[model samples]
Target: MRSLSLLLFTFLCTCVPAQTIAQTVDTLMEYTAPSATITAYGNEPGIGTAAPVALLQQEELTRYDKSSLLSGLNRVPGVRFEERATASYRIAIRGASLRAPFGVRNTQVYWNGIPFGEPGGDVPLSFLDAVNTDRVQIIKGPSGGFYGPGTAGTLLMNTESIHQEGLFKLAPRYANASITTGSYGFLRADATIQRTKEAGTYNQFRIGYQRTDGYRDHSGMDRLTLQYTSTFRGQKSGAKTALHALYTKLDYELPGGLNPEQYADNPRQARPGSADKNASIHYHNLLLGLTDERSLGSWKLESALYTTGFYFDHPFNFDYKREANLGAGGRFALRRLLRDDLALALGVESRLQYRNGQNFTNPDGTRPGDLNFSDEIFSRQGLAFGQLTYTPGAWDFHLGLSSSQLDYSVDRTFSAEGVTGETEFTANRPVSVRLAAGRTFDFGYLYLSRTDGFSPPTLDEFRTNEGGLNVDLDPEIGTNYEVGFSTSVAGKFFPSISVFHFALDEAITSFSDDRGTQLFRNAGKTRQQGIELAASWRAISTTDKAIGLSFYTSYTYYNFTYLELERGGTDFSGQDIPGAVPHTLNVEVGIDLRNGLRLDLFHNYTDAIPLNDANDVFADSFHLLRAKLSYPFKSFNVFVAGANLLDQRMSFGNDLNPQFGRRYFQPAPGRNWQVGMSWTAAPKR
Candidate 1:
């Protein structure tokens, strides 16, 4: 690790000194947009509505980890992460990660208006490099009514727009190159170039590489990515079009979880069979999309086309599997303003997926011993929805209906070399309506809403232990009621609070069968209620703006329980839901010094969580403290950051449902540090 860091430093030092560009000074304000105004008042009017949302920009996240998503997104309220190892992350928005054993579920993700998550509702986050995104908008709510069937929330990420840098009067092009190195054998390099023509055309491209010899045995990771974005004015006035391409190649070693005693004895040890089994994952993913929006008189139109594909090879202790997937989807919406106070929107979308995969037996955990199962799966989804929004003076009202259907079919071609072909088909149709009303105050806004959401099982969730299909599982449905209010004081303090209650019918939970094969079942009904609050106050500052200080905090409290449930005729009523995140608190302080130097301190705390439906096993609570320092000179910059400065010995992520050995802990690095340098050619100050 030390050698790699030294080499990276030498290379960056030799390159950055000669390339610095001129720039300006900067600081942050508490609030900019005081009222609820649709970002789409100009385009894509129906895609995202006004709600309790969070926006983070490059300026705020520039110093964080360039390869990890949790670094920046964790600052937002009601967001948390679990990591099985380096480059592996599971994120939950508003405690929506109930049954997601891996990756992000119950959330939708978009890149430049293109739905990458689509109807499958699984976010490809590990494939995304944090530095590639210049802006992120997090919409926290039941997203089924607007962004497909995601019951938790939605994320929109986009590259920087050159026009926003004062392109009209100044330079129309800029480029930057950066190098970063850190503890645990980390090394990264990235280059971004952008150009904008005077005729309203935009183009940007980025390429990055990351490698790390992780803290634990058999946990190394490496990734490479390339992304390009283009935007231009359409032939019609008030119309714009955008095209985006993002490609990633990633591979990571998987060190399975550790038991409690094993964790305490040797925190840096890998799972028992991890090294011998050579467990790991290698994958390639690509996203291509085009988005167009236009305005014709009082009506606005939005449309998008996207195609995504991935191929992966996963080798574990018991199975060697390979899979390939290809999917295509598009969305269309037409919204019109009624008179001056009312607006109506209608939309429809379709998505199709074709997949081919196979599982092979692994006795020695090296090569394929024999064909265990081979299958082909396909799914088709259709959605149609409409919404009516009315603003009568200070009051805002919205009502919407969302209806969707999916058809899934599977064909098993081979199993154990002796099994005959088997086939199964499933069709699911789910519907829901959403209603909301809010009033604007001089300080902020007050809102209340009732919504319904639906989520269907994914292909992996539908596969049976015998490698055929689980034809009995049903879609999980939820009904939500929430009230929220937000306010800002003197442009220095901002506060928001919300309370919510919900009942999830046919809640889908998971358990292992007698043969130790994982399975999914509709466990029964669950009830959840929660309160969340986020506030920020300028603890200290100066009139000259040379030095400033601010403090921000977010807190959440929730009670999620199984209201009614039965397993093997044993009534497990009123049991705490497994993996339910009950309490979380985050506090941050920002300090800025003159001459473009800054310091930030962050502290996060989470309560212990139940790890099983039986509620006896638990993952212990943990606290983390992190810090970052940065200084900018001209267009050249340097940053240093450290994580887990307190050296907390605990799991960063854990398995909610595990085998009998209590192997749930995925230990985090004790203390890690990173240093980076960058040089840029940017618009004139």
Candidate 2:
């Protein structure tokens, strides 16, 4: 069967027409549209919007190695993506990662306009394949006034199945397939099929699979995913409907955090007792979504509904646990043009989640020995938002207001004491407000904005691994002030800069107990300020009819400190925040030879990071270099890439405020390389 499949793929690659390949490549290379008004948030261009918005188009996404999304995301200033190990991911916008021990927190994420964040405040970013994504938009700072209550920021992600008007629209049917293999026993394969008709109907289906023998012991991973999307436009009603469905099965081993001695002796070795304990995670998830849009005279309405279910099985040195989670949510919005220069919008969003969890004593980590605890958890969140926009001449004005509430309960059906009743907690409802104004001049655009919002504790934070709840945790309230400017030099060099200051009361942070159980608490207050700069230059364009060259760079500088905090008889006031880097710089260069050959190079530099609250321990700064080269002929394209070319030993993610002095580092992979080929078939227009 394997031989037959390989033969079929070879035939498809060799039998396709050559004339259409250039057209397909050109269509995929188009990059300027996503940064335009099509971006979320008021459907306005970046210069016209008062917020600090960063956009990554498909062309930028494809410029790096396709194994992970971290490379592309880190290119944006004030944003960070951490890879603790293969298939393990953590995302932070600005300095929000302080509250996230694992996974994604504080930030709100949307996939294809559907809220990807669950009621528990976790976004499953590891389940997504970066190569399958078409675009990304990050709105920095508190965006609760329009995107719901979030103190970190907001993220909007659109996958390839959404159809960005180039591939599917050019033909009735299109197909593409690719396979990749790399170091550390890495392998990946994927295929996509799309169909579109002139009657305004479209459908797309995609499947992907990946596996890897990770760099460290007990860090292997395997994943398989399936996705489908469909769209239809009513001919008479003048309405549009879209459906999206996705399923994923993922399994990964956990090597655990290593102390300094263990890391220096053997960087590739798993933590002590980890291998004997069978530390690993098994995950399965399914998500479905539906969206509809219609026009009523002078008003427009948009609505979306989504549901998700997931099963998680984890084994660790401390215990073995299993959980099943279910969630559902909906969003609705109405937009109207009150006048030619004025607009009004109103929206509502809500989410609900339920979980059944069980924990047991792990004699060998794989099997449960004794029932430790079992609990049922429920959470709900809701928000109502409104916005008004007025544009006169070359000036733009925006006012946004929102109110949000959250509640959760824990029912300990079976515990050490057995049959514990439920305990509920209701968070303080807050009213969020945002005001902004922008002006467009002949040479550039300038804007100033202020926002106020709050973030509450997540379900995981409230319920600790010790099978108990923490009821004293409170929400973190913050205010942000920002100023930004963007301009173009000679229609080729694009540059943008933003500076902001954020003050928070009762900031949330994490700590671990002596038993290795993670917990959360509110710090007194924090003051964070930062500067971000991004620029792009098209040195040579295809329109010039010669070799095309482009360069892009982003830089970030942060001065984050604790304004007031007291822990364990120590005053930590005026200390730098742990887990937040002070400086970062990223640069990339893309070269396209008109003759079907391409080259891309990327460089990243991160400053030393504080690892503990005392500010005595710090992770060393590091530099990384990567490059990729590809060539296309007829209908097939082949590529080769390398990562971490410097072979530097660095801790990409740190376990902050560890109870044990030395157990604070999660070393990243050393050096790696990959090669792959893809075949695409598109109809002639």
Candidate 3:
């Protein structure tokens, strides 16, 4: 706690005063952020299998008022969220979280050019506030070769840019503030300011405070966040540079899981031992980065350097831990237009991460004590990839190749007198290829692709060394083939559909033992196949009320199962892979009137999921209904929002496979509501 405060004080002292904006700046490769153009691909677009991408901007993002990040991500296809409590989030892309009961694994997240993941391959969302984001992008599929290994996919979060449109001389400087209160005793307050003093330069700052007394016992959460962004551009060279820094303090209580009987008895009650033990986590996260973009005679160059670290103290039922995570990385890319019909892109990236931590002994209902072990973990990754695209008339052909090397090591510096510790080291080099062909016409386009993926076990999966390191586990490797097409009718209706099949070797599986220790094992073989569809129609439109009567929806069918497996004297072959949901659907209806009023409605449904490898236990199917309304005034905005309007009894967090049903169900919140107002000011030139 002291360390976090000291760091916070030091950072606040270094903030430079900002001025007013002079011009508008543009962002590339971000499809829906203020502009959606076919050429938005820019240079950094996805390189393989044309991973389905989704982007949310403006109202689609701000309506939730940062209450729950999942509320926004749920609108995207092939995405799911496991929420154990407010701000404690686990995001799954195509069932990538099958092995993780909590936290984000097998997926990578980035914000303002900095990675949210640690050296151990785990990314926790507790340190982030949704209000700090301006746009969100998701890439669905294993992009291991291009984005460090993760079988699931990638999430890209972008901050509000100081150089965006609507911030020119007319609005050279501005400040905004908002306060909100909601059901379950949720409260939030925030302030933001932006300025630009010189041409092609600007600065932005934001700070927020939020607290929530959860719907269940012992599930309260609170957070504080501060962020700063600046941009500097060279007038003569036309070089653009951006800098970002962020710090956040967060701590949340853990109302442990419940067994089936306990769940039916009382869904809002905390586990007996959890309340007395004060099970919770206190975390402090810090991030910094610098990015540059420039243009050569016939080529463009882009680069970024970033550093991130976090300090956390966790006290749980079976163990206690204090962790210091540090990581650094850089990326460089060059793209050239060799000819009118040809384009080429080459990029290289490298990352290094290290974690120093200590583990202690904790009794069933007491605080941590007795330093039992001290360990250090190290991870390094490097990738080089290239892509070529040819365009002639309505036909486009693309090919890409990437090679990556990932290394991991864990060393136990000290251990209790009676316990022996073991050190482990390993490495994997994976190569991937992407091939796709597409054709576009006035009405639509068609595309097909093939790609490969690879992801290794995370640090949590290795911590159960039982004295030494768990060395029997291998990485999950797979190949995917897919085909898709999209079309539009009369410029008012749009639809897209895709189908994919992926086969894996040495798939990772999760399990917990009687001693309360989590473990990971390799399943012999597995396969995942799914179909996804998305569509939008504009029933009413005019110059002033464009897309006023618009409706959009997305649906998915996932059949992920084990092809063969034998572990712990159990033959679990041919069973539906536990934790991987089989079906999901989302629907939304948005209406905008010329009178400056907006109303949006949404619905989501999820099919039952297997809770065990034997496929005997299950979590029933569930659906959610949500709505939001907003009205704009001359200087401020008024809004109201509600989630899970049906107030159904369901559980979003599931204990993948438990030994004695200790904590297999963590209930979801019932219906909730919030109302807020926003005010903005910007003096004209």
Candidate 4:
């Protein structure tokens, strides 16, 4: 705590009196969208938004090493990204990891305006290559009134360039390629090519491959990705259309968590019996999407359709599983100006999926011995939403409403006893509502909002890997209230502050049974509140001389606790929320010199985290330091990066509420280094 305070004070003292610069550089790093093209609301500027939102452009994204988004996303006040192993990712937005045993849930995700993720609420982020992403927009707090049924907010990712329309600013044709190598036997290569025709047609293609030996035993990963995006404006129809396609083949080894003793002895070793089982995952995925926008007289229409197909082959210490899935979804919306100062919009979205899975006993961890169970599952979810936005003078008002429903059925074809009939679980229809008001001032924007939402159980929580089915689990319902303000001081210092309180009923959390099966159950109630502060400063800027210095810092404070909870005859009321760290801070400094040379230094400090609902175990706090340097020539750039400069021993993703004090630690790599070079070819302006 003392060190954290000292660092914060030093950073503030160094940034306060810096000379102001032009708005161009500051806008690129952090700024409100000047238009609604990249957001969900109507066509308006940031003053019209009444909720907290974070936008990261390409320049801000490349400040990291480009290996993973963990460090980059941590810059966001209330967002947390964790990795249990190589390519095994999890995300929590303004919430704890109680329900997210693996993957992302509770939050809604979109790619290029098309709905992404499985119908069952699991987002496979591992399939995405961060290098291809051009921008990311995060809407904080509950946003089901516009995005569907979710309590943890929304994430919109744009892989295509923002300069795809209007006059062409870049060369008609361009190509870029890069390769990187790092410690722990990490290797990566990727290339991209783009072409634009005089007839208003643009196309881009990208391919990437990555492999790593990993830091722990039996933890290795390999992946191949291919993506294509095309956009064009109709010559006579006066309409625009975009097509997107993505494919990935991923393979990763899973080194099971370590117990306290094993961690103290050798944190690099695999869990007991994991070697005999050869635990790993193999996945193949393909996704296709299309988006179209056109004018219907005085109204505007936008629609999106997408399909996804994937196969999963996984082996664990207890069982081996094979699964296949196919899903499709689409969204349609229409917007119009009822009056000069008022606008209305309506949309509908639906998704359906079918999955077939078979589990087998793994005697040697490498091969299946006998089939334990075979089952099939079908899931469907849909939502209808409408919103009204009124902007009159300096006051902005927004109201949104939505109705959502979810249902799923499971049929067991074969089990230990015999064939079983189908079992169904249908959730009650829920209505979500949001109301917001904002006031814009010459110095800044101030806003407040209220949101009510519900999140249904995901397929992974309903059916465990051990073939156990749970139908009694209920959806989590919650209400959130937030207020925030952001401002810029002389185009040199940008700062923002947000405060929120969320109350939830029937909170969903996970637990492990004695047989190693992870399951979900509804806890009683919870009260969560937090404060977020973020600031960015351009300490010195001299574009003419090509010398610049900048600093960014974010701080988060969580005061979350259980209101009412009882499990297994033990009272757990009033305990701090497990997996919810009380405090987190991130600081980054960038230095730019002459001749396109740059350096970035980062520091991250995380408070101790409770590892169980009972509050009997906790993971100690730790500090992480990283640095990167780059130098550019005419057509190519070379860079070097290092992580964990202090060589701190730390656990990144810890398993919460393990059964009978079992393995709960996932240690991160001690130290690593990376070197890479990139080349680009383009026509002169």
Candidate 5:
């Protein structure tokens, strides 16, 4: 009890002053300028648009590291992070599956305006470092129109750019560094450097490294990343370029399922004589972008063009895989403010992507073996969208519409010792539309309506010779609906609530045939509904003593039932879909002390999920607790964190990836602690 009191006291002292000062200054600076200045081509509200839709500013992101940033973004309801290992994570939104070996399906991840996914629409989260991001946006449901056609969800991450304001003014400007250690052998370090000037030109660089000796045996990882952004401005146009690169080497022990006896006695023990696997992945991405703004009569024209390239390589278990992607896109927008009450924006965009890759398998456990399979694919898309806003008295109304078309083609070949053949090239075309509406009232309250479309399968679903497998899959479609309200109370408290439902059709499923080879099939209907609530407040405010509190919680209910199934040439009904957790809860709270000190608490709970169609294997419910404390000074920062405070063991999947067991596959680590410090000195002004 004494320790708890002290912890709370410390938190209150750190945050109060900052909160009070910010509020006072913001209130005093609420005066409006002479006229409303608006830019076209900007899709969403800018820095200080609506009270609820305001973009998070730069200061809000400074204290966060990669993992915390990802975890703290719970604003998007029904999004969950699947911990693959210490440094590897998969983001699952609204019950979307993350088990595809080739890559993640149904989700699209983007950095800046460029895609961070494989050409075939697989997003690998291991390549991104959240610590370096300036802002993160999550678009839920089947809103793939902004990216491509197949994704059901989109994660957009924006990194710091060189053209930002207030970067180069201070002599020997400000800088900071952070280090963290937790469960397993988790260790992470992040640092940033920036240079800004009054000429509208700036340069920023971020570097990060992470390593972990995983909870399970034979699971370990090392990851390194570097990113840079630079911008140059001319009279009416600007050129912005970003470079990002990452290298990850993972030596993970695979945990095959255990029999009944082994499970009951010791779940964390490793199976005997299992093969040790080493996997290495290299990712490189570069983006070059240009933006131009000009005026024609009373209207403004905004345009942007971007080109990006990504490459990947993996070598493991006598197999070598490699892939490369090149993509380019351009967007043009027209914007105008009509009278004093209306604003309009219209934009058109087109993107083209090409991918080439090959997978080779051999008995020698080395490269240059027999070419087992190879694939080459091409994808192209175009989109047109428009948004209009009208402000009349206390009511603010917004409307948006977008349409898209996608075309994809794939060529595949499979070669075995005796059987060698090429599958006929396949092509697919998918189209989609989206609509959204929202209204803001006088009391800082808002209501919204939205619908987004998602495209299903492509050539990868039908090519038999593509990867030594046969897939006769059909496209799956998704429709999502959402409603929400948000407002702040007492000028010091902020809160929001939202509810959403998603419906999926022709969902993809995989099953093994009599020959033991797996095949893909389109399954039945699945639905997910959930609610989210979050609040933040300044608990204590004063000149000499400061304190603050923030809390966020969310709950989700997901249900999946097989509408149709075929078993051994016979129909089987009334089976629960595997890997669907019915319920999930997440909560977080944090406090700041006056003397540059901070403390945070977090919790997560997930209900049981089915292992297989028969419900034979079940992953039980589990809870996790974590805490962190940090102190900052003029030149350096130090922090400590503890994870799995309760030593809870939970598994996400039934047999495929059973978490922390008596054997070597323990997914979560036992209680552990770590502390580290770093110092930074910025360049002279």
Candidate 6:
């Protein structure tokens, strides 16, 4: 790949003059809140609630961890990341496409508040592990409809909390580790532990493990994860409380494909002993939460409650399934600012869900063996919302209103040799409505904006895939438009630009016949538009002279068209719209070398896609490069890194699952390396 694109353009030209002098002294000591703010009304932390874009820091995601989260958020700007192998991965904004694997519809995922897809809205990025995240909020279009209702384009992952004057106070916190051997036997591990004190409380923990023996042929993978957080405080109604937990394990190896001369003699071959193909998966998750805040003189109240659980054992193709889930949700808010530029918010939300399953078949049948049959399901939802904000000066305004309700039910049974059957149902009143807008301006110092939104759909969209039978499908609507601009210039430098348009209506599709079973249909319209650009600079700073420079780049153009389709009875509209991807690009550069040496570089590009929709397999355009180096003594700190260097060979499938060719699958880890260190201890007032 042209020496991995000339060693990532010579490591971003030697780290762009020390990341433009440390982003002009870190934007003059950072801290600049209040630019048309919102954060669910005064719960600080980058102020939330809506109308605030551009916030993705943690040193721009320390070169990513956890098998890379969409290659570090696709370097921002209308993001895009879609990989079906390597434990599957997906993300698309402005032009969504997860190529359906039974889920991923219109993007919608939330962790801190539970509900992370799967009930047909597929969202399974190996269940997260971007070094245990602390921030990642990108809500564009349809104003993310308050976190529910088929997210018109959303990606919100915030985790990292545990405070209480540092609890058992024990300072000296810092540790780092990494070991990667890429290409076809990929392996990874990550670790973190933190503590803080100043009467604000704190504690954070994270651990991750990964394995890969894939490059094709029955692919391979094994994974593990763990996380914990805690916090507590109370002093004159300034109360606070939080607790969180997570656990995971996964195993994989399923290679099913042949014919065409056994895939041109070894696309990394693995067939012959196809014992009913192969597949095995197991998963488990649990979460509990509670939060509260109080104030009177100026009116402020916040409340939250949550409980969630999930278990799974999925054996594909030859069928062998067992699933379980339990859920609970709650939210309440009240805020007031009426005097300072006007502001008001009132909210209510509720959620409940349960599901059970079983499926087995093989006894003389052509695969998918054992267990017989069973099923169960139940669901509920309710929401009431109100919001208003105004600024007067720069014409900053926002308004919102919502009313929602949904209910569902299902049951079934069946036994083979002895013969038995039964099924039941229920579904009712699913409704939705939401809206949003924004505006800002300031020529010289640069800062401009324009926004819009919409979202609707629920009640699992009229059930029927083997439960609560009722396929009267209707629901699923979205609309969004945007325009943006930002600047900083002299204070070192920063730049931004954005443009978008998206549309979806009654869109839900699934197909599988000829006795393969799997059906669900509803299609009519789908659309996506895009544009995004970003920049950051500093060059160098003095205080003993510190060098710095940061860079960012983005590009995305996608289109998925298929106005309508209804087989058998004949009806097909425009066509073209199966895993759409016209172009994608990302660039990164970082350097702080002034003694404690540090350097980072990255590059990625993807174009050409269409392995299905009868577009006849196609996948071209590829580039990747990475590097990292770090050093810091005293408390202990050391590092080294490399990836792909230049071993490009990529291929992804989607037309009825056709993953073949380019033997490396996603191979690029050819130049492997890693080293670790960390030690800290300080707690004595």
* Highest lDDT against the true fold, candidate: 2
Candidate 4 CA-lDDT value: 0.81
Give the TM-score (vs. native) of candidate 6.
Answer: 0.31
Local accuracy of candidate 4 as per-residue lDDT tens digits, 1-685: 2234234323422332222232222322232322324375544544367888898876666666666677777789999888888888888889788988777888888888888887657888888877667678888878855886778878888885434332134446555667789999998777767678745478888777778899999899888777899988888877889999999888889887887889889989988777678889989999999999999999899999999999999888888999999999999999988998898999998988999999998888767779999888999988898988998998889888898888889999989768688999887546788999989899998999999878888889888887777788888899999999989999999999999999999998987766556778899899999999999999888575568899999999999899999887999999998888899999999999966689999999989999898998888889999999999765568999999999888876877888854777889999899999975554433
TM-score of each: 0.91, 0.94, 0.91, 0.93, 0.79, 0.31
Clashes of 2: 0
Candidate 1 per-residue lDDT over residues 84-123, each given as its tens digit: 7988888777763555766677777777777766355667
The clash numbers for all candidates, in the given order, read 0, 0, 5, 1, 28, 38
Cα lDDT tens digits for candidate 3, 209-318? 78888988999988888888899999999999999888888988888778888888998998777777777888888888898889988889878889988897888767
Give the backbone clash total of model 3: 5
Higher-TM-score candidate of 3 and 4: 4
Better-scoring candidate (TM-score), 4 or 6 = 4
Worst 10 residues of 6 by lDDT: 660-669
Candidate 4 matches the true fold with a TM-score of 0.93
Ranking by lDDT: 2, 4, 1, 3, 5, 6
Candidate 5 lDDT (Cα, 0 to 1): 0.54
- lDDT of all the models against the reference? 0.74, 0.82, 0.74, 0.81, 0.54, 0.54
Pairs that collide in candidate 2 are: none
On TM-score, the leading prediction is 2
In model 2, where do residues sit more than 4 Å from their true spots? 1-35, 44-47, 160-170, 683-685
Candidate 2 weakest lDDT stretch, 10 residues: 30-39
Least well predicted 10-residue stretch by lDDT in candidate 5: 31-40
- Give per-model CA RMSD: 3.9, 2.8, 4.6, 8.3, 8.1, 23.7
